[model samples]
Target: MGTKRLKKQWLLHAVGGLLMTGLGLSLFGEALIKKWENAPLWDWLLWGTLALLVFNAGVSLVGQAVVFRVKLDGRNEK
Candidate 1:
């Protein structure tokens, strides 16, 4: 059913977002601990990429939550 498919998609997005957040945090922590002051361009690039990943994950999670909530509210109203 459509509801089942929606649930599956939401679950997938939630899981993917969590994974990306975890990975981004780990990378960020490692970079901080290693003191990236004198790190090469590649290291900075990696950090920037991780930061972007975290930001993107957060956005995706929030977007999914909003969509799910709207769908749930609509169903309840019907």
Candidate 2:
């Protein structure tokens, strides 16, 4: 029950993080290097977004792992 929910959450969180970072990098493409000089705001925005996504993904992974470990340990020992 809760284990399944955690698993789903983990998947979504990880996928979301990958998508965010990938999308930003893809959009930047060859012009990414120029962002530093022409548009510092956009550069910062992209970096901040990626950082948030990564942090969320990491938290989700840890949470899911803990939930799963508890559930597994609680099972009948006989």
Clashes of each: 0, 0
TM-score of 2: 0.47
Candidate 2 segments exceeding 4 Å error = 1-39, 76-78
- Each prediction's TM-score against the native? 0.64, 0.47
Q: Residue-wise lDDT of candidate 1 within 9-50, one digit each (tens)?
A: 667777777777777777777667555576776776777677
Worst 10-residue lDDT window, candidate 2:
25-34
Pick out the ten consecutive residues of candidate 1 with the lowest summed lDDT. 1-10
Question: Between which residue pairs do clashes occur in model 2?
Answer: none
lDDT of 2 by residue, 1-78 (tens): 665665565566556656655655554452455465576766756755665665566556556556655654565332
lDDT for each candidate structure: 0.71, 0.57
**Local error of candidate 1 at 62, Å?**
4.6
Candidate 1 residues lying further than 4 Å off, grouped into runs, are: 36-38, 41-45
List of clashing residue pairs for candidate 1 = none
lDDT for position 32 in model 1: 72
